[model samples]
Target: MSDFQPAGDGSGLRVDLLAIADLIEPSSRVLDIGCGDGELLHFLSGSKDVDGRGVELSQAGVNACVSRGLSVVQGDADADLANYPEQAFDYVVLSQTLQATRNPRQVLLELVRIGRRAIVTFPNFGNWRIRWRLMAGGRMPMMGNPGEYWYETPNIHPCTIRDFVVLCRDLGLSIEHQRVLDGAGKAQTVRIGGSWANLFGGQGLFMLRRP
Candidate 1:
């Protein structure tokens, strides 16, 4: 319904969504948190034959996914994840939604508890432009494409790549794979806590599991 193969690239996914799909394997059971319009689920079902389920916060989003024949339900991420059973899924993905949650740490715990592996992605709050904007303007920074006003934006408690790494270490979550994507939306080599990712990377994606 939403154009499954936008560019004939086989996945019909956006830059970020394509990357997230690449991290998933064939025929895996996946639960997508904040799965905006079920684009990823649609793509996965077509390309990977995955068992995909999604939870979205908006009715419109849910409707869109349903129209595409994806299994999706409307729900709040911060509260709903707690109701899912332990290790019920092979993979749980929280793509670019970490910062918007009411309690990221608790949500993170639930992610690992509900799935054997958790894939998380978020915009890097430590991008130099974000830093420069706040420092230069003495106010909360405008962000993302066609950036929104500080007070009106949905993003709350945004964190950096370094900050996320620290939190994962503190929580004892195993980071099986990690990537820092730059402004062009391409992943770059990064070492945990290294200055490059903290200073220049505009986004981060990570795969986690409990040890």
Candidate 2:
């Protein structure tokens, strides 16, 4: 086991990333796409016995990761991935970033193509809170950390958990494991939590394998 450190924000790595790490084998190779500030990659490298690299579009994010002694490349996901050979990593991670891409499906396909397993996390658009907001407010719904001005929001392909699962089935991606997050960003417990996840969970984490 490696030493653990809190994420800069002190809440530690997002619960989704921690769950994904649990699924990964020790000393695995990981590539994190759209790795803002490389928090997840840094945590995995330091605390999970994984070799990690990050691809980030923001120069500031890239610089921050590099300064932390983490390997990172400054490039867009839509473009940078083309340079990596097929199956170059054990796991390719896309956390909280799939919705921000201009081409979510294409990027997801690329992730699976470039790695044996893919870990993906994203905000759930079909949460009951969001649904209620849309139904009563007549506007795009916002909640938790995603609340922001429409013009400034990074989510380009916001989708629901059901939408994501449907897409995976349509694309022939097999889900290996999954978890949902509550409003507090903690993993929702099973039992009743799954029901809430199906209706009101704020985010989702999935481990996918190509079929």
Candidate 3:
């Protein structure tokens, strides 16, 4: 394994967000969709020197971001991405929000349409623990990150790494870079068109762009 990871400042950002920050270039324009409290936006602005902006679904989140002096507005991804013109930013990021979206494919289309590169992350439904829970106990695994029961959770369409790969292919988005992380938020060895990443990865992060 390469053990290559995104740079971090020990700012208490989630491992995935730190990973995302590593992918972004300096002085670029960034739009973070579903940016809860603008942690990633704040980190990117300070660490990468990017002009960062955010779109949040909750007023609480927007208020938090604003308090932190980050440019964030209350908006929903399913409804607002279309308002932006093409390639308005250098990078557009959506972390842990794709599955909860009403139309994941449509949102993805808009991501690449509005930014030169789109960075995305999601929980992996095909992880071994999740599979074993379903197979052995006939129950869905409870995710700790969001900490909600399956019935109470808002993720309408949970998907795996393999599923996302297929969707990206269907959408004709090129996968410039991808990372599969274990439960501890460490990167795993990449294996494209293989089941290892799907079977073992607890979370998946991808960088995509239109051809």
TM-score of 1: 0.92
Provide the global lDDT of candidate 3 against the true structure: 0.86
Q: Estimate, for each residue in 48-157, the C-alpha lDDT of model 3 and write its tens digit.
A: 89999999999999999999999988999999999999999999999888988999999999999999999998888888888998899997777534457788877888
Task: Quickly count the clashes in candidate 3.
Answer: 0
Clashing residue pairs found in predicted model 3: none
Greater lDDT among 2 and 3 belongs to 3
Q: Which regions of candidate 3 deviate over 4 angstroms?
A: 1-9, 144-147, 190-192
Q: Sorted by lDDT, highest first, which candidate order results?
A: 3, 1, 2
Q: Encode model 1's per-residue lDDT on 81-153: one tens digit a residue.
A: 9889999999999987888899999999999999999999888889899899889988887654345776877
What TM-score goes with each of the models? 0.92, 0.88, 0.92
Q: What is the C-alpha local distance difference test score of each model?
A: 0.84, 0.79, 0.86
Return the clash pairs for model 2, or none.
none
* Superposition TM-score, candidate 2 onto the true structure: 0.88
| Highest lDDT scorer | 3
Q: By the TM-score metric, which is better: model 1 or model 2?
A: 1
